[model samples]
Target: MYPTDFIERINSLKKELETKTPLRIEDEKRLKKKLRLEFNYNSNHLEGNTLTYGQTELLLLHDKSTGDVKLSDIEEMKAHDVALSQIEEMARENERPLTESFICELNKLILVRPFWKEATDFNGNTTRKKIEIGKYKSTPNSVRLRNGEIHEYASVEATPAMMTDLIDWYRENEPSMHPVQLAALFHYKFVCIHPFDDGNGRVSRLIMNYILLKNNYPPIIIKSADKENYLTSLQKADTGKQLAIIEYVEQQAIWSLELSLKAANGEDLEEKGDIDKEIELLKREKLSKTTNFKSKNTVYDLINHLHDDLWNSISLQLLKFKDFYEKANNEIILNHELDQKLSLTIRDNFNLFKILAPAIKIAIKDNHLDSTDNFYDIKNLLWIWSYSSNKTATKDIEETIEMNLQLEFKFYEISLVNNKYELERNGSLISTTIIYQSKNDYDTRITSESINNILKSISKQLIKQIKEEE
Candidate 1:
């Protein structure tokens, strides 16, 4: 029953993907609502299937017997509900358009959740214990179960500098890595860092999905049933024994991509083209590799593909607009006006694409493309832009182009601010800002020097705010 809902949801998503029109706020709201409904329906269906005969009997017996069995079950059920509720709330709060920093912050949140207090060892020792669970034994102290022994573990404390370093590395390197490979490496490194005393496994998994979701991919659920295999893969990755983690992540991504495709198409499921083969072909054709491909070849290929697809879709819009004017039989002036508006829109899209170009290039610097896969269809590209545009067209196409360019600038500004904050934590300080000013007088003059001064002031203020938060 749970799987049925999953399939149904996937099918719905596939249909949604066909609408290449830009996303409006209403569309986003609708999506959120539908997602919540699907999540609840599936969760409830699973809970129903998991109820045991004894549990059913106990419910009936509680009405007849004097024992406290019913009460105990009720308490346990309530606790479980509370935990799930907390998790749902956290997930909802973190929901937003995907960004690298946002994903990292979410990972931190999942890692630091209080749920660790409830995790217990074989000896009934909770994760809260400061000393190793079994000092007399040879088992290593850690939160994880090793062999048949429960070991006591000491938590590794991390300085602010260490966290800053990790973020910097991710920012500097992630663009060049294949999204799957980058996600897998981050999972491995974060777990190895063991930034938190406990819950590292769960947190790492959450982080993996956060990255996927941000990139318009579905989430992967590492079921408790596959715990052993999952742990083994992690161990292999940690020891540098093999690319087990990478393989695992790739498999998960394939599964997610398939599910999303199915959902968008309103189908239960369907066969997919071989992803590895496609990648290989892309490589052979030199389509997967980008100009900046160097180290993280796979990630670079994916990002570049996405960027190209987006540009192509926008170009199609320009062609369509041109056709509208060319084929018109009446309203020559109105057609001209419409054409002008669309041209402006195209120009705006171009500027936005230009701003995003660097980020895509950065993402590709590490991985040379081996092959190109059509990960994004034309409709998907349109959806992304529509959603990003927030349903409002600029007063003129040129204005729209300027607006998108501004968004890119703002994204960079934010990134720079974050970088500065990280550096300040390491005893270095820097400030930067951007400001726009206007005068009412018709012949008012503006100077680049004044603009620079405003930017500096804004930067300094941004730094000050960051420090205050610290």
Candidate 2:
């Protein structure tokens, strides 16, 4: 047994499994649906699929689509969901002793409608190829390492025999090996074989979960946020250093069990410390470095004045601005009514800015506004205000506020380099100008026209820079 809390948790989970008290119908349906969606989303995301969690939820839950993602991505997400349901059904129906035929069926189900792909051959020459759905590879397959050396897998002729040996080994070891170890080892061996021409990673992951599910364990998810660690672990496994991958998957499995235990007890899923914890951690770290700007103008006063001006500006009419709250992308929108209240809150509690900054950063990052390559037209983004208190200010005076306010526009250059998202510094722009009440600072009079013009300027340069990089 590993010397970790997760191993202890696994032992506890073993006891829970012994309960044999089946989950409530509502809990069963809810947990299964949530796990299916999360598993499909995270697994596909690891393979560089571009569907957002929001898009995945919309598509899988409501048959709705958002954003300008590719059709192939959409189709694959749907197919992956179908495959998940099939696997869960198999687990629930007492299907055991998984075989090559069953694995192949899953592979076929995942890539339900496989198509041709243009890929480089083993010799580094590009060629058009057909990816056989649900079948073994017809040609040799290997991966090029970071050092430009190819790591070849078993020959096409040897793949079938290797897979058979793998299954036989699995069957023989099942009785003695812990289910987690069995699943992890199988996942490692299957990935090393690279059985199919495509969808090998996704299929291997599916098989790993199948092993766990068949053993009355919850499915483990490899989140995309840990993509780098996951890949590095796999690479290490290739070098006979399997501990990293083993521990990583075990931690994920522990997390899965935690969620399952909670759900079975009628607990709210949000209590799980995952995506929310990440957001909070990121906020704490990123906001700590924010510089404070001192000024005589209070945040409340400044925001109130700007709000009234923009509220009655002709430029708002020219820009077809709405009278109330509306969604807008990169283009910044300001609502005096809302801003007044938010500004006051920040004024009273400066530390609250830490929370706000991370919220804005997440919104920008998740929406892909930072990367020009993935920018979404956020049609209605209201002004995001951040502030801090001045120790120099007398205790309760409103004008003595030390709120450092700015409309920050940070642009990032992204390239689809080698079919991967790479950040480039060629045309990256970072603008942070503090808003002040100095009479000479004409920029203080924020208007819809000025905001729109600024977006146009930044986007134009962004587009040109991206084109040049391409």
Q: After superposition, how far is residue 226 of candidate 2 from its true place, in Å?
A: 0.6
User: Which candidate has the highest lDDT of all?
Assistant: 2
Identify the candidate with maximal TM-score: 2
TM-score of model 2 relative to the true fold?
Answer: 0.56
lDDT of 2 by residue, 198-282 (tens): 9999999988998888888899999888888888888999899876677778888888887887777887776355476446435
At residue 15, candidate 1 shows an lDDT of: 49
Candidate 1 TM-score over all chains jointly? 0.35
* Cα misplacement distance, residue 279 of candidate 2 (Å): 14
lDDT score at residue 426, model 2, on the 0-100 scale: 36
* Residue range 1-470, candidate 1, lDDT tens digits: 11222334444544465463334555444444333323322222233323232232222223221111222233323333333334444445544433334434443333222211234555766543332211111223354456664433323333234445666776676566555566677777766655544334544555655555544545554544455677788777756754787666666555555554444444443234334433533443353223322223322332343233333233333333331121111000001112221121212433443334344343223232223331111001111222121122321111011011111101111011122212224533333222332321111112224434544544454335434532
